[model samples]
Target: MNEVKASMAGSVWKIVAKEGEQVKSGEDVAILESMKMEIPIPSEADGTVKELKVAEGDFVNEGDVIAIIE
Candidate 1:
C-alpha cells in the first residue's frame, strides 16, 4: 500500500476520487487550495483508492497523509 501525502500545508478543495476507485499514475486525485491558488494533487502510482484521510474543507500540513492506495 502507498500513502499519498500532502506536498504543502493547505485546505482540501475537493475530492476527485472516491474509495475503491481505480486510479492511474499522474491522475488528479484531489485538489488543494493554498496561498490563494488551487493545486492539483496527482497520484504517484496506479492503484485503487484505499482510504481518504481528509475531506473537502479539511486543513492539512506538508507530509500529512491524505489518502492511501493499494
Candidate 2:
C-alpha cells in the first residue's frame, strides 16, 4: 500500500475519487485550497483508492496522509 500525502497545509476542496475507485498515476485525486489557490492532488501510483483520510472542507497539514492506495 502507498500513502498519498498532502504537500502543504490546505482545506480539501474537492474529492475526485472515492473508496474502491481505481486511479492512475498523474490523475487528479482531489483538489485542495491553500493561500487562495486551488491545487490538484494527483495519485502517486496506479491503484485502488483504499481510503480517504480527509473530507471536503477539512484542514490538512503538510505531509499528512490524505489517502491510502493499494
Give the alpha carbon lDDT tens digit for every residue of 11-49 in model 1.
Answer: 999999899999998998899999999988888999999
RMSD of 2: 0.6
Q: Deviation in angstroms for 5 in model 2?
A: 0.3
TM-score against truth, every candidate: 0.96, 0.96
Worst 10 residues of 2 by lDDT: 23-32
- The TM-score of candidate 1 is 0.96
**Stretches of candidate 2 above 4 Å error?**
none
* Predicted structure 2, TM vs. truth: 0.96
lDDT against true structure, model 2? 0.92
The lDDT of each candidate is: 0.92, 0.92
